[model samples]
Target: MIALSDTVSASSDLLSTEIDGEVVMMDMEAGRYLYLDRIGSVIWSELKRPQTVADLCQSLADRYAAPIEQIECDVLDLLQQMRRNDLIRLHD
Candidate 1:
């Protein structure tokens, strides 16, 4: 499992675009495309640079009405899913 302190960022070779508050990502290596909703898009934008899971949760908490714990849980789950799909990568 990814720890809260682990930093993560988008893969360098992937292509991404934002449309109507959503994000569309294409993995050049895997030849797969993933669509992200508004919340996912926000997370995707933040992943432009490596960031800690805590930072991501707090950022979303400030912008969204959800609880911090819920945000953290959701963010962690999403990150793990993205990792499995080779969309985002863990950084040092």
Candidate 2:
């Protein structure tokens, strides 16, 4: 599972984000478009790195100076929302 801590962008993919921080996804394979929000932005930014759940929790905790437990909860909750929207893929 990807954690919500680091940020990443690949050299290959092509998708343009809008002025209001809303994401517009362009599917290279299917040739389509999509949209995302500010909350999505936060989660998407974190997915830039191939980090584990623990690593992401640590990063969020450090960024907000919150407890690891609380950050872990936030990470899990945020990832859950992202997953529901098909914003990100979760790996084993």
CA RMSD, predictions in order:
1.0, 4.8
Candidate 2 collision pairs: 7-48, 8-48
Those runs of model 1 whose alpha carbons end farther than 4 Å from true positions after fitting are none
lDDT by candidate, in order shown: 0.89, 0.60
lDDT tens string, model 1, 1-92? 98889988887777889999999988787788889999898899999988898998898999999999999999999999988888888877
lDDT of 1: 0.89
Task: Mark the regions of model 2 whose C-alpha exceeds 4 Å error after superposition.
Answer: 1-40
TM-score of each: 0.93, 0.57
Each model's total of backbone clashes: 0, 2
Ten contiguous residues minimizing lDDT sum, candidate 2: 3-12
lDDT of 2 by residue, 1-92 (tens): 44444332222354656557766777576587666577556556666655666776676667676788877787777676655545555554
RMSD of 2: 4.8
